[model samples]
Target: MAILDNTSLQLPKENPGAEDFLPLLGTDHVELYVGNAKQAAHYYISAWGFQPLAYAGLETGLKDKVSYVLQQDKIRLVLTSPLRSGGPINKHIDAHGDGVKAIALWVDDATKSHHETTKRGADSYLEPKTLKDKDGEVVLSGIHTYGETVHIFVERSNYNGVFLPGYISWNPHYKAPEVGLKYIDHMVGNVGWNEMDKWCRFYEKVMGFAQLISFDDKDISTEYTALMSKVMSNGNGRIKFPINEPAEGRKKSQIEEYIEFYNGAGVQHMAMATDNIIETVTALKNRGIEFLTVPASYYEDVLDRVGEIDEDLMPLKELSILIDRDDEGYLLQIFTKPILDRPTMFIEIIQRKGAKSFGKGNFKALFEAIEREQESRGTL
Candidate 1:
């Protein structure tokens, strides 16, 4: 039996002390630091179905950094590269590969969000600054999080600019069809030893977040590795973050392996929501994205545990997308291998078809699958 926490998905109820979060303002945008912005943008548009939305580079007068913006549904991603070498952007890429650098939070007031988080001890990355152009003015502020990652507060109430002032409206000849991905579900981070609770408290006290769920090292441990995680949620449940910390194991846990390769703490996985995961995963696989595979025997008794799924059982087996259901509804979810060389970043496809729970039932299978990767990489 799983050591289900009190805060695990349990019907219409929510975790205590978790304030009523207003429906998330939706994803403001996800900014990533990469080695090459142009190539990264192509990967997203040509392969991942994101349409080019904005652009800023040497041509845009930014001599130090270049950024490419892409969007699909409510999510936007800004891929940035250092125009000149040896800057902080280069350092970030050197450390974490092409990983998430900032998760910009959409808010009604950028200044207020900055004051609130900074007063609560968030180190200021960008002072509340307003940028204006012919289109309009946008106010943005930011604070540092674990590793080189950051959370930028975007106040766009008075802005009509394409993106920010520096970026201009980008019109690309290529625009891929929407992949059915709607919004961000949750972002997972991997920290060094015993640091999970530290960041958990940072969110609780600094950002008005609350612990939604937790798993001990034992619950998430493989035979040769162990890690601990705690889920934190914003008021509206729109933003959820799962923080992971490595623990002593016979060999090395995935978290430790990431820290070793990435050189520090950073994002581990980003879960994006979709209404039709079966179709989405099918599309993703056909587009050349690789997903983990599990043993055939694992599927033999799945129904005996989670009951029936609307999808054809054979397709689920064929594609390797895992399905699980709770009292509320069933959700389809699948994880991808590390997108970059360091093994610090990956993507998750999630579809909530009524069930409100994270796929707790898939934990054993998922970890086993991850361990197989670890074995190949010689980390475990």
Candidate 2:
């Protein structure tokens, strides 16, 4: 799917002669290794209003795994489960409950992507391979990143199947109206202690991404919790990954809690973009989606900090949406509680006005809200 058309989300100014060996079209798909693809698919469809797009499993000649593809606008999610026990898929499930396994990128040359990454120190996950069916051919290649997460390069300019060749159109009787989720804004990952810089450099040297921004613990800390984050972006600013690590604090940091419960470092949340957060949030909440809410006091002084915005303050305050502004523009965002029981993975709904920066201004209130949830869960 083509990326959502938004002038505010345009590419930022590129770095001076930064290596563009691996140019990406955009995020192709994010595949999560879930315990049950069917139930997970149902939850996203019913709660998030994602339409079923495709399916691949035993019926499609894949014996070991079953995958359900769901799409909403330009965002596509692949939920997969191992059909039988005792394999790499099972091992992954055992290691990290339900979490993201791969962040696929749309590219023009999968072979070149793989060659450049591996030659630059990334471990090979999958050699370049061509998959074809009636529609056309697609070339796929992959390389390993932090923890068990992989970046799969997908060359689909020549393909036109539902998802790929193996998957068939999945049109189920159950369907819901679109929730206005346009596309993925950014995805954040939590790593083990002192591993944030390692992965950040990997993205810089291996994947040719530049450090767009960085937040030390002081910039993103509360009274009792702290963590550090560094934002990495590709050449054209289409992909942004904010890698985070726990910092010393009086209480247990949220990143530490995620690492412990998740059995290691992994994706913490995937942020999706929408044009209208008030409507999008209203639809999601009415559909049983739960979000982390800051106290009403957060909004009392927000306008003074963020300046004037196009949206009204009452609806944003009532919905508990957080606002932040950069030199470019402001953005509205809200975070959901963990979608799974492990408290490892969650989702963020963000609407950028003209800002290319993440919600750094809201980190204090956001983390305080998270600390409250962690206290209730007894993980703090």
Among all candidates shown, the one with the greatest TM-score: 2
What candidate 2 gets wrong by more than 4 Å, as runs, is: 1-17
lDDT of each: 0.81, 0.91
Q: Residues 203-301, candidate 1, lDDT per residue (tens digit)?
A: 888887888778886677767777788899876676889999987778877888888888899889889998888888888877778888888887898
lDDT of 2 by residue, 84-126 (tens): 9999989999989999999998888899999999999999999
- In model 1, which regions exceed 4 Å deviation? 1-16, 19-24
| Highest lDDT model number | 2
Using Cα atoms with residue i matched to residue i, what is each candidate's TM-score against the true structure? 0.93, 0.96
TM-score of 2: 0.96
Lowest-sum lDDT 10-residue window in model 2:
1-10
